[model samples]
Structure formats: structure tokens, C-alpha cells
Target: MTNDFSPLSQWQLDRARRTVHRGGVIAYPTEGVWGLGCDPWNPDAVEEILELKQRPAHKGLILVAASTDQIEFLLAPLDPEMRERATRHWPGPVTCLLPDPEDRVPFLVKGDHSAIAVRVSDHPVVKALCEAAGQPLVSTSCNPAGRPPARHGWQVRRYFGQGQVHIVPGALGGNRKPSRILDIVTGQWLR
Candidate 1:
């Protein structure tokens, strides 16, 4: 999908990319709401997000990427049909749980599960941020477990305060709800 939306300044994108590379957490707009993202391979960064949201480690987190190629290492093992099933709903508000047989993903990112949740986002800001970081990022709702996900920049600020997370400037995508999550391996709708 084409991403003509460019709501963020180059400086903002660069700062976010730097923060991710430095193992800091950042809040950026996503398909339905603001999202907290960090380098998925950085365990400390992932822990910071979990702590900020008061989320349990076992729940795992989703990885968002600019394109399927960014996550090709994980998807390459799946059969052609299973891979197609997951890719068909991507570049949009859909997350698919795919088996991580080779354990390419970190334990913190996958939690206790054998499968990891991932999405290829069409949101320009998300795509840009992922591209800037040159890897998939750990994505979770900006709010704490019980709080509503942040839909506005101010909401993100209110939830985590200014210095807690580096806020990447942008507006949420048109989706009114969070991404639909599906377990492609089991053919189950998880959300």
C-alpha cells in the first residue's frame, strides 16, 4: 500500500530512530491509537515498556514493520498458504500470530508463547519509524493495562508524561478499533 501521509518532521523521525537505537522507548501513532515501541531485540528497552504499562511479561508484544521483507526471517519458514494467509491482511490493522520455530525472536518479545504477534503497518509514521530503525519494533498500546489506548498526542503525554517516552509526532490512522489479531497457525481470531 502507498503511504502518502507525512505528518512527522524529519527531525522527529530521526530523533525517534535515535531513541530506538539507544534502547529507549518511544510513543508513536499507529492504525487505531498511539503505540509504545522500542527495539524488540533490546531486553532492557522492552522491560521499560512493560513496566510503564504495568503489563505482564507473559502477555508478549506485537512487532510492527514497514514491510513483510523486514520480517522475512520469521515468515520464511511457514508454508506458502500459511504465509499468504497472514500477509493478505497486512499493511493495515491486522496482527497475525506466527510460529517462531527457530527462535529468532527474543524471549521477552515472544513472552512464553511459541508464536509471536506481528504486523506490517500501512501507517506512514509507523512505516517510516520502522524503516528508520531498520528493524521491526516492539509495539503495544500506549496506555497501561486498564486504561484506554491513547488516540491523541496529549493522551500519550498524559499517560506517560513528557520525558518518560519520546513522542513521535503523527495522527492515528482511520481505524476506530485496535488491529484484529489472528492465529494463522490455528486459524483462530484472537481479538
Candidate 2:
């Protein structure tokens, strides 16, 4: 019998990619922490992540992509210099802000800012998930507000417990530092 809850497969991964076509929340690995992600288009799913983490919606979230192209809808409108300026930092930990392409973006994801933070990841699994999912996800550190970020699957399980998440199996990437947060406009590191 196929266990309903075995680790993910290429098929399930493909399914996840397709399912996210409509927008939903998911968890995946990041450089130094596991991250919670969702379809930026789905306000309900984004809201679910906020509720799950007890995160204040106004704090905003990051978006992760398989490639700069995955978020083309959000990036295409940027002036060439602005687009080039932002693309220079990607396929790595540096997240940058770009204009929101659609009104579907919730105020929570934009936080108090005028632009949304996004990145194209270098991590293999994150690349695969976004590649398979075929869209950038609303990426944020996986933890309750005021708690430590989860660095391993077990830590993620311990923090959220089994019922809330469909934990994808993987080893954490060997990065000592979490992704650096910067104001793309000011070049200031917020974290």
C-alpha cells in the first residue's frame, strides 16, 4: 500500500507545482533555516502562514524563485536599470525588492514597504521546488514570531508539530548565516 504520508516524490513535487498554480502555502529548505512559502496570489494561503507562525501581517515576507523568469510578471514592469540592478544579486541569499505586479499582493506581504522582497535561490532543493512549482513562493523564516528559526526538519517538526505541516525531507544546506535582509533602495542590512 502506498502510505499516504511518505516523503515527497517527483510526482508529488510536480503535483505541488501544479497545485501552487492556484496559490497555496508550503514549507521548504533555505540556506540556514527552513522557510514557509505560499502563493503570493492567494490571500487565504498567505493568511494561513501568518496565523500558523503568529506572525504580524505587517512585517511582510520574502518571495523565492527558481529563476528570475519565474516572477516575470512582477519584474517585467521594472525599468531596465532597476531590473538589472535587482537581478545582479540573485541565485543566492540576497533578497531584493521589486514592484508588485498585481493587486492580489496582500498588504502583509508588502509589510510597511512600497516594494516586495524576492530572490532567486541557489539551493538545489529550493531551485527544484520552485522549478517544479513553476512560480515564486512567499518565502519567510519558519518560526512563530519571537521564536528561533527552525534549522532542521526535526526542529521544524518540534516547533510546529506534525499536524500543521507536510514536512518535506532534506538536509539543511551548510550555511552559517541566514539570508541577509537589505533595503534594495538603501543597501542597508536589516538582518
How high is each candidate's TM-score?
0.95, 0.84
lDDT of 2 by residue, 24-91 (tens): 55667777688887777688878888998998888888888999889787778877877777778787
| For every candidate, C-alpha RMSD to the true structure in Å | 1.7, 5.3
Superposed by TM-score, candidate 2 places the C-alpha of residue 174 at a distance from the truth, in angstroms, of 2.5
lDDT score for residue 13 of model 1? 83
Kindly list the per-residue Cα lDDT of model 1 for residues 75-133, writing each as its tens digit: 99999989999999988889999999999999888999999999999899999999999
Native-referenced Cα lDDT, model 1? 0.92
Q: In model 2, which residue pairs have backbone atoms overlapping below 3 Å?
A: 17-133
User: Which candidate has the top score in lDDT?
Assistant: 1
RMSD of 2: 5.3
lDDT of each: 0.92, 0.75
Instruction: Identify the runs in model 1 with alpha carbons over 4 angstroms from their true place.
Output: 1-6
